[model samples]
Target: MGHAADSVTACLSKGLGASVGTIIAGSKSFIAKAKIPRKTLGSGMRQVGVLCAPALVALEENKAKILAEGLNKIKGLKVDTASVQTNIVYSDILKGSNITETHLCKILEAHGVLTMPKGPFKLRLVIHHQISESDVKYTVLHSESCNWVHW
Candidate 1:
């Protein structure tokens, strides 16, 4: 069996970058309850093997390397290193900061880095197997270089 992106958010879109959820392991009772909500949320898809195959590969191969990259790599983006336990990293903008989240997002996106904004000055950055250490450094450097006040 190959690796898989075990995620509740379909792996690809928000969870594991698989574009589909594959790994399901829970008590029968728990699964039964979850299935109802899963269906209600339209999480099911046809011929998911195509997506699952890659997800499996990823889980088996890249899990450790990706984890070791760490959440503290992104400079200027403050994240409590001890608190990060997964691929998600959250950063907040100061109340009096000149840059807004939207402005920062646009600046990052312009450089081919995409991020999700949580609030006017907050951002949620997700790290995955596709992101390399060099990529992280570049993103951090570029992010720090953004002068949103002028824009």
Candidate 2:
């Protein structure tokens, strides 16, 4: 399980590096600072080629899915921006409505959508693998239902 988890983490880190047009180098410099015994700390798993194999497989299988999800999130953000009528859509809304982003997030969660409040009047809607087109529409509709007037 540790090997599997490490592999997944490594794969993800690599993917992140690639998306940003960065290269990841294999270095052991960071391991030198470890004070814990290898056997007891399970750090002995380093340099295990077998674990890397599964990580590689996971990366190949999941890369497309991850990219698609990212695209969906970008689309959701665009939708949110287009639907906004107020300039202070983030933190100011919270101040006037007496509702925190977390509270609104719960509301969205109940509606089968998920979001985070950015500031007092600002909120951020995050689209994930589980969110569908209908979910995005619902969020837009729900946000539109709110009557926010700027003073």
On lDDT, the candidate that comes out on top is 1
Give all candidates' CA lDDT scores. Answer: 0.61, 0.41
TM-score of each: 0.54, 0.34
Instruction: Return the lDDT, model 1, position 93.
Output: 62
Count of steric clashes across candidates, in order: 13, 10
Worst 10 residues of 1 by lDDT: 1-10
Best by TM-score: 1
Show where candidate 1 strays beyond 4 Å. 1-20, 27-77, 147-151
Give lDDT for model 1: 0.61
Residue-level lDDT of model 2, residues 1-151, one tens digit each, is 3443312123323322222221223335534433245456653544445545544444444333322333234312212333332111222243455555566566657766556677654565433323445654666555444432222
The window of 10 residues in a row where model 2 has the poorest summed lDDT is 15-24
Q: lDDT at 62 for candidate 1?
A: 38
lDDT of 1 at 41: 93
